[model samples]
Target: MSGSPPRRGSALAADRAEPRAVRTRERVVRALFDALAAAPLEELTVARLCRDAGVHRVTFYGHWPDIRTLAADVFAEEVDRLARVPEDVISEAAGPAELAAAYERALRDQLREILERRDVYRTLFASGSDAGFRRRLLAAQQERAEAAVTQLARAGAEVPGRASAYPAAFIAGGVVAAFEAWAVGGATGVEAAARAITAQLPGWWPR
Candidate 1:
């Protein structure tokens, strides 16, 4: 007889390995973030990152092929965290005022996260940095913004224009610019930045 099919949970556990491996991966990524904040990505080496993370070079290799891969993973994780905020903020049942309040809350969450990681974000997105990395990060944000627009549309909200995507892309670009300014200390504060982003959304949703 053929071998039995792998159990679902067992398959997942195998993919993730044990808790120790997960912790090590987290440490490696965190170390990369810390290291990148202090210097450019070109300056980082696997040996240095391994030393900083207190993990073996073999372990680092097991998790990622190179620093760029690790950087992509870190960006993906950051984007996923930001995406979760909108789920709590937008609801199908929310009225116009309620939706506005929720948008404010979500905007605050996004700005607060940027402030918390200001150094790292500035390092990654600063002009003359890694073009690929900046493009990936911005693309992720655009995807998130597009997803948010889809959610609003599904909730029976009236988005501007026959092409909802145009507004979404515009909003995403504005958000990126706002965060860049805030990251560089051009914006007055997190609240002000949040207000600016929140203002842009009002026209997209029925008020």
Candidate 2:
């Protein structure tokens, strides 16, 4: 954990690039979700989704076992949307300061994303499409948590093997709560919550 991150472009590329398989997968997920907005998730059918995506039934079944699994996955992907910019926004970060600053920016971005995609979240959250709302939301939050871990780990913090996942989970829960308390009221405290959580990490911050 010393020199610059290994193949920054190559690594970052992996984050952005959607292989054909991934694109098809995401398209199917999105199609299913869009259909859910029109009706509840339970109403979605493989035949309808394939038609929406202009794909074939055989292809759909090749990728998904059943519509429920596909529905669960669609929700998972939707909730798990993440951005990878805050860490790069700041330059020579060190210790908690750097992490906190990036946290603030990222939190702000998250709110912006939520607000901008309000229609999407509202439809998804309101549709009560699937029984896996909480689970999918948790999964979504975990993606962000894991991204932060990668950033911090690259920054220099030695993540304790035993308690690694705990920090992210604790922090992500805090994030959602803050959004509920302040963001729900049309106020913005995302940055504040992010800073607070990042400060709680048990090691020096990374740049």
Candidate 3:
């Protein structure tokens, strides 16, 4: 015999609730960014966030444990958005030198964007910022770097007789640290920061 029919009423209620949940999330994110524009994350409180978002404290707690968690979610989204390089530029590289140049260009572009929002990032990524946020941010960047390096290795990029993970980790860790330092130093000189990063890549890398 067939199983009993699904609960249509419950399913319908969930379906309707999803959009409202999404809207609430959007409002919270908007409020967080707006607040950050005027004040640092350290100064932001759950009460103020809920007030600005027009959400209740219970509603805010329903989504995140505290302000730092919500801030992490917001900054994570920004990091991912700024970290993505133009795929077409990478794909169209005619040789290793071109590919390296493309990578530098992409890095500079990303840095420029970050420099535009320097105050916000400087506060969020500073030494005094949330440790969990920094860890998650570094992990996300490392994961992306690992995947890219792995793909390059599969496509004939050199790795100095070691596995791709070695270079991936080195580059990811160095770049993240370099950028974090740059942010902590008042987020100046995008060109200098980008150059410092590109200079660290080993000769065996795609360059």
What TM-score quantifies how close candidate 1 is to the native fold? Answer: 0.67
Candidate 2 lDDT by residue in tens digits, 1-207: 778653321113233344765776777777875786687555677899999988887766656666765654554454355434443453466654576566566556666655544444444444353534445666567667776666667666676662568867765676655444433345345556556555654564443
| Candidate ordering by lDDT (highest first) | 3, 1, 2
lDDT (Cα, tens digit) per residue for candidate 3, span 69-161: 676666756775666657776677575566666657767876775677666666667634443567767777777677667556555677664
| Poorly placed runs, candidate 3 (over 4 Å) | 1-18, 127-131, 161-164
Candidate 1 Cα deviation (angstroms), residue 106: 2.0
Q: Candidate 1 overall Cα lDDT vs. reference? A: 0.66
Candidate that would win on lDDT: 3
Report how far residue 66 has shifted in candidate 1, in Å: 5.7
- Residue 129 CA error for candidate 3 (Å)? 8.3
**Candidate 2 — worst ten consecutive residues by lDDT sum?**
7-16
lDDT of 1 by residue, 78-107 (tens): 744664544555654466456545655666
Q: What ranges in model 1 sit over 4 Å off? A: 1-24, 33-45, 54-76, 86-89, 127-131, 162-164, 186-188
Cα RMSDs of all predictions? 6.8, 10.8, 6.7
